[model samples]
Target: MTDLAGHEGAWREFRAALASPRMHHAWMLTGLKGLGKGQFARAAAAELVAEPGIPQPPAEAHPDILIPEHPPENKDEAKKREDGGEYRRKRAIPIEEIRTLIQRLHTRPTLGSRRAVIIDPADDLERNAANALLKALEEPPAGTYFLLVTHRPGRLLPTIRSRCRVLRFNPLDHAAMERILRESAPQAEAAARAAAIAAAEGSPGAALDFVDQDLGRLHQVMLRLIAEGDEHFALRGELAEEIGTRPDRERQQAAVDLARAVVAAELGRGDARRNQAVIQVHGDLVRLSGQLPTYNFDPALVVMEIGALLASLAMPREAA
Candidate 1:
C-alpha cells in the first residue's frame, strides 16, 4: 500500500508535488506487467483517499476514488453490480464515463482530503476516447489527479503521453519476490517461484500464474520439451483432448497458447543460431492460435509437425 519504489527521491518528488497541491494532472506509469502497475496506481490514488498510517478506503471502487467500472446500463452504479462483462474487457472508457468522473471529482470528497482516478492500461483507450481524455487532461480540475498505468506507453497517444509525467516501474529484486511468495503463496516451492521469475520476464503478477496446477504442469513439461525432445507422441492426444474440450472460449484459446509457447521455447533453444527453425515454428504457433476458434486442426498433428520441424534443424544436413 505504501510507495514501494523505495527510492527516496521518487517518494520525495511525489510528496513534494502533493505539498505544492499540484500533482501531475495525468501520470503515466510505464513498465512491464505484474511489476505492480495496478498496485502502484491504487497507492497513488489512495494518497488522496487513504493516506499512509491511515485505514484503507472502504473499497477501492468508492465513487470519490474512481477506478473505471464497466456497467452496461443494466446495473446500479452505487451498488457496483456486475455487468456480466469482466472488469478487464477492452471497451473504451466512454465520454459519458469521463464526464461522470469529472462530476464526481468536482464534488466535495466523501472521505479523503483529495480525489483521484486511475485508468489501468490507458493504452486500451480508442482513438476518439484518448482524444476526449486528452481534452480533460489539458485542463484537469484543481485538487484531482489521474494515474494512467500501462505496460506499453508507446501505444498511447503521443500527445497524451506528453501531457503526463512518466514514471518507469521496474521489477522487485529476487529477495522481494521471495518475501511476497512466502507470505502469499507458501504452497509454492522457493525454486518454483525463482523459476517462475524467469518465465515472468520480470513481472510478479505473471509469476503468480504458476499457482495454477494446469499451468504448473505445462511449465515443467514445456521446459523439459524445450531442452530435450519429447519423442513420445503421447502428449498429442492428451493436448488435443484438453484443448478441444475446453468449456469456454477463453480456455480454448489458452490451450492453443500453451502449445504455442511450448513449441516456441523449443525453437529458441540457442541464440537463434537456428532462426529459420524458430521462424517456421513461430508461424505454426500463430496459425495454431488463429485457428483455435475457426477450425479444428488436430492438436496432435500440430504438435508433431512443430516437433518434427525443430528436430530437422538438428539433423546432419544442417551440420554443414
Candidate 2:
C-alpha cells in the first residue's frame, strides 16, 4: 500500500467511518485522476477484511474484496449496436452485472469480518446499473461495504450520492511530489524534482508525466503565448492540432493547467499585455474543461474553437 502515492489521511477517514454506530452502506470517494482513490478503497477493504485478531487483510487470498472494471462482459452487444447490427448494451456497467454483484453481497462473507465491493470510477455505471446500486444502498446488507471511487462524482445518480458518505481526496503537495519524482528518476532528480513540483499542481501522479520531456516545451509555448503572444498562424495551429490529437482526458486537464501556469507567470511579471492574454486564455481553458465530458464533440472542433480563441489573444490591445 506504500506504493500508492498522493493520498494522505486515508486511514483517519476510514477510522472515522468505522467509529460510527451505523456506517453508511455506500461511500463516494471523489477526487481527480491519479490521486489514489483506488488505493484508499483497498486500504479500507483491508480493514473490513481484517479479523478482530488479524493485523491486516489476507493479502494472498481475500474473498471479501471485489473490483469491477469497465467494458462489461456484454461489450460485444455494444459493438453490435455501434455497427448497426443490433441495438443492445448501451452503457459500461449493465444492470445484470450490478444485480450479480448485489446477489453476491447477500450472503455472509466466506472469510473475513465483512464484505466490500469497490467500483472504480463508479460514474461509468449505466443508468439501470446505478438504479440497482441505489436500491442496495437504500437497504444494505449488514456488514457489507460499497466503495465507489470516481473522478466525476457529479455524473453519478443524485440519489446514490445523497445516501453515501462523501470523502474528498486532495492532490499531493510539493514535498510529496518531489519525493515521488526523486524515487522514480534519480538520474534526472534535479530537473524532475523541479518540473514535478511545478507541473504537479498538487498531484504526485501528474509529476510522472513530466518525465516525457514535454513539460519544457509546454512551458515554453505557454510562456510565448502569454508574453509575446502568437501571430504565427502555423505555430498556433501546430499547438492546436497537437492538443487535439491527445486522447487522454487528463492531458486535456494538463493543457488547462498550462493555461493556469501562464496566468501565474504573467501576473508575476506585471506585464499588462501578457496579463491580459493570460486572463483571456484562462477563460478559454475554463470553457474547454467544461466541454471535455461530451463524447460527441469533434476533436477538430475543440482544437479550432480554443485555437481561434488563443489566436485572438495575440492581438495587442489598449488598456481598458
Candidate 3:
C-alpha cells in the first residue's frame, strides 16, 4: 500500500464525512498531479464496497468497485478479446466507457451494500463522456458512489463541480518529502536523496522520480557553468552534450527540470546581475522542451544553444 504521506488532513476529513449521517454520493479529489490522488480514491473505494464490520478489501479483491482511466494507445485488442470481451483501455475515456459503467451501476451490488466507481483523472473525459457522467451524478443509483480525481477541476463542467464534494490536497512539505524519499529510495546515498528532495520543491512524486538520478552532481555542474560565465565554451558545450544524449525521455526531462531548479536557487540567492539571464534561460528551456516532440529538434543542439546564451550573459561590456 502506498502511504498517503502528507495527506493526513484530507484523509481525516474524508473519514469524518464517511461517518456522517448524510454521506455525499460523489466526491472530486482536487490536487496537483503526483500527489497520490488516485491511490486515496482507490483505498477509499475499497472501504466503501466492503461489507459492514469487515476489513477493507484490497483493490483487486473488491468486486463491487471499478477504477477506470485512459488506456495506452498500444493496448492489445487480441489479448482483450481473449479475456472475454473485457473493455480495452484507450487513450481517452470515451462516452462508451462511461455508458458501460452507468449500465453496470444500475444493477444491484454483487459483493457488498454499495457499488463504487473511481475515475483516476476525470479531466481526460471528452465532452460527451463528461455529460454522460453528469447524468449519473444528477440521479445517482442507490448504493452507488463516485470518486473523481482531477488536477484541474476548473475544466470540469460547472454543474458537475457543483454537485460533487471537493477535497483539496496540497503539496507536501520538506519533512514529508524527505520521509517519502527515504522509503522510496532506501538504497540512494544521503547526498543524492537530499539533492532530489531540494529539486522536488515539496513534491514527493517529483522527488521519487529523481531518486536514482545523479542530480547532486548535475546541480553542481549547472552552478559551475553559471559561475564560469561564457569564458569556457568547451566545458559548457560538453555538459550540454551529455544532457542531450540521454536515451530515456523521463531521465532527460528530469535532468532538464533539475537544471531549472538550480537556476531558481541561484535567483533566490539575491544575485541581481544574472536575474534576467536566469529567467531567459528558463523560458528558453521550457519553450524548447515543449516543441521537442513536434519539431523534432536535436537535444544536443538545444543544450548547446542554451549554454551559449548563459555564457554570453556574463561577457564583459568591452568584450561585447
Higher-ranked by TM-score: 1 or 2:
2
Q: Cα miss at 151, model 2 (Å)?
A: 2.2
Location of the lowest summed lDDT over 10 successive residues in candidate 3:
288-297
Q: What lDDT would each prediction earn against the true structure?
A: 0.61, 0.68, 0.74
lDDT of 3 at 239: 68
Q: What lDDT is obtained when candidate 2 is compared to the true structure?
A: 0.68
1-320: candidate 1 lDDT, tens digit per residue: 35664334455666677677456677888876667877767766766566556566444756567876443433354234354433333234556666666667667766656678788768656576677778878887766778898766876888888989987777667676676667767888767776665555455666665444345554554444445454574544344454344335455544445545455555445544565666666676666655554455555565555445434444332540
TM-score of 1: 0.68
TM-scores of the candidates in the order shown: 0.68, 0.74, 0.72
Error of 2 at 101 (Å): 1.6
For candidate 1, what's the RMSD?
Answer: 5.9
By lDDT, who's the top model here?
Answer: 3
TM-score, cand. 3: 0.72
For model 3, the stretches where C-alpha displacement exceeds 4 angstroms are 1-3, 53-56, 75-91, 213-320
- Winner by TM-score: 2
